[model samples]
Target chain A: MHPTSDKFIPFITPETRHFWEGTKLGELRIQKCDSCGHKYFPPRPFCPKCSSKDISLVLCSGEAKLYSYVISHLPAPGFKPPFSIAVVELLEGPRLMSNVIGCPQTPSSLLLDMPLAVVYEKLSDEIILPLFKPTEKIV
Target chain B: MKNQKLVVIGAAETTSLGDIPHLSQVQLHADGALNALADAGLKISDVDGIATAGENPITIAQYLGIHPEWIDGTSVGGCSFMMHIRHSLSAITSGLCKTILITHGESGKSRIPPPEWPWPPRPGSYEGQFEAPFGTMGPPDLLTIPFLRYMEDYNITVEDLAMVPVIQREWAALNPKAWFKEPITVQDVLDSKMIAYPFTLFMCCPRTDGGGALVITTEERAKDLPGKEVYVLGAGESGETMLISQMQDFTTSRAFKTSANRAFLEAGIEREDVDHLMLYDAFAHLPIYGLEDLGFCERGEAPNFIRDRNTAPGGRLPVNTNGGGLSYMHSGMYGMYAMQESIRQVRKVAAAQVPDVKISVAHGIGGMFSASGTVIFSNQPN
Candidate 1:
């Protein structure tokens, strides 16, 4: 069968299945090192700082801040030109790449250090992505 | 190892610089390896060790039909060549191998088939799971994202960032092999087509097909060769994170700082002692980060230092004299080309030669500030 073009699909792994599941459930999930109390993004089984296998999956506050970003003028498959590709810093002390939707993708509109909240995007039956959006309400 | 002196006996790029559609990727590696061996006045049979990145060392060795005792296929990213240099020093000094050859080549612009990696990565890989869903395809998207945070924190203007390519173009204007040789202005960089925010097309390195190689050996052996010897005084390699967002800080690359510091310490040279510098410029912001992270300037000072013409032509520190990745040719892996320019400067034969360059530093970043390698070359070993 011929596959569809202009679509972004993320692969789910055994270690990361929980992350996709949480996103589909409208929850933002992150990994935490139970030994060191260090929260990290982009799920891995072991702790980055302490190398502790004593890690747990926890629901995040869904709160973040716009740490950095760039509005791409060049077109990418499944993305419109001039959309923000950003790094959002979670309040739990981990940062991840995401898009700032529900706002103009402009430098003036997307201010640095601005408060953000997680919004899930269901790409397919198997994958769900956690995106970000600006918010005035404090967590 | 400290007592043993190591030198680069051979250095050369592919026969042609850019726009070679006929050569396959692996063939490009062979072309560069062959040219570098020729420059050293040696044959492939004369080599006892092989090290390469991008292409597998085993493939490269078998392709050249040389069986070696030491092989390093350390593939991190563009900076893999730098790490290869660091490893080759250890292998040669420890008597593991003599006459080590490090090569690099890529069909970046040609789109040669085979070994093609799918976009968005596979579902199970870390990058595929995290970065790809965000539309981060290549360097322009992912690498340039961090600059805005740096600029905001440092209060640097877009005009200051534009000066990086402008000054490098001045150097490229002197070098005949550079891809973009025309001298441009800050206005011109701003006016060029924008690829990503804070990064115009002029600010990004051009995608072109090219390759370069280096032959390293003991100083005693290099003396027998016809080429001038560029001694490897010190080298360092460091890694941070594969994920760009996981980087400790957006403003500074921890890997860059760690690698550069280790290199400078081992070289026993102060920043002022460096006669020339080659900070890989995959994007305009890279050199800025290099200037500060490498300790050439203080935090939040590189933009102004560059704007003040400190790193430009006739400035105190001559940087990217071979036009760098931005103006010089940027194959997929750029570290080899960066090292070639440093070797040329130390040899006193560079197209845009820095006068009396006794010491030179080549710093490279791999995979979006994820990894770094720094090498120091000198005409004299202390």
Candidate 2:
């Protein structure tokens, strides 16, 4: 059943099924290159660093810092009025682009170098989108 | 005796830039290709290599009625065709093809009426189900983050950034082929529509439909060609990532920095040696970032340089002589035109060509400053 606020779907792609299954267990999963030891987003079968097929999925620290972000005021079809999309350079050093929730979507609100923590948005039954919110919710 | 040369023997464009309601994208591209070939006194059979950006690669091939030995269809961004010219030179140098036809065209204006892409909403994709839902359709609005960063990093005022579209509008006024030829002052740019914060409507390159092409050949073949021969000196390319959000630096284009340095070094030239610069100005703030990245100004000093009129027609450097993508026309593809402008200046054929253009740098950034291709050209054979 869908939530009154929004729905969470747990649909998974072939390459990321394991990752999603892990997220379903309340863990943030990331893949690190076994050969080069580099981490990456948009998880792939092979490591982008050294193109090594050998990689491992590991739980990640959801805490992160704001790398960059943009807020949109103009309205589009599906999304709510406005939101700030960002690249969260995870404290683990792997960068992931996700929405920063619980904050006003404005330049003044989405400060670069700001401290934030992940907030998982259960989009559908199978899909768990990780979002970020400022720790202090600083005004 | 095996050493051959690849020179730009011909170039041409549509008569004007605007909503080309009459022609399809492929037709527009073909018209430009035929015109460029005619300028070189050549025919379709003369072109063995076809490099293009955007859709309709085979349509152009069939329309021209030739099976090309090479089809360089890398849609890196607006500046890709300029990169293609460099790649074409490499192809010729490596004995891939002698006569090459490079082109850009699109009914970008008319294409808007088509339905949205049939592809499903991709959550991982920053576009579609992500940014598009929150508004951010394309170009000007999407460029807002970098626009803000430019101001934050440089202490530039909105008026200083407005100088781009304003000055470009003046140049467009002179080019009969320009889309919006109306003259605009800095006040007009600031006063125009505001799409995003700090960026007004006039400060952005408009969406339009048009086509342009260039035919390059080797120096050995340059002996018999009647058209003015422009030489390809050096080229470089770099990109951090296809996705905009993942780039390590937001205020700067990593591709632009790496590629510009590589371009100059390969050309065996220094920044001071370049006489004319053709930078892709799809967004008003782009040229400012590019200039700083290319070392035309000290870090954070591009606005001051613009204030000094360094890039204006009568300034120390003349950029975008043919109105640039801002005023001329942006058919969602500007790389070929970037190459075309450099060739025109080198050959002294542009309507606004400066008299002393020796080395010209054509810069292009694609996909949210992800892809970069830099080319340095000269009249002298290198």
> Which candidate gets the maximum DockQ versus the true structure?
1
| Candidate 2 chain B weakest lDDT stretch, 10 residues | B112-121
Among all windows of 10 consecutive residues in model 1 chain B, the one with the lowest summed lDDT is: B111-120
lDDT of 1 by residue, B206-282 (tens): 87897888999999898888877888999989999888888889999999999999998988889989989999999
Question: What is the number of residue pairs that collide in model 2?
Answer: 19
Residue B183 error, candidate 2, Å: 4.1
Instruction: Give me candidate 2's interface root-mean-square deviation.
Output: 4.8
Task: Give per-residue lDDT, candidate 2, residue B50.
Answer: 89
- CAPRI quality of model 2: acceptable
In order, candidate lDDTs are: 0.89, 0.75
Tens digit per residue, CA lDDT, model 2, B1-382? 1256567887888655588888877778888888888888788988888888875567678887868998888777777786787788788888888888888777777873342332233644534433442334555556555555557656678888888877776667767777778888889887876555566777667778888888888877867878778777778888777556666666677888999998887777899888999989887888888888888887778877877778877888888888888888777777777777888888887877687888898999887777899988889875
Interface RMSD for all numbered candidates? 1.1, 4.8
TM for candidate 1 is 0.97
Q: Score the docking of each candidate (DockQ).
A: 0.78, 0.26
DockQ for candidate 1, please give it: 0.78
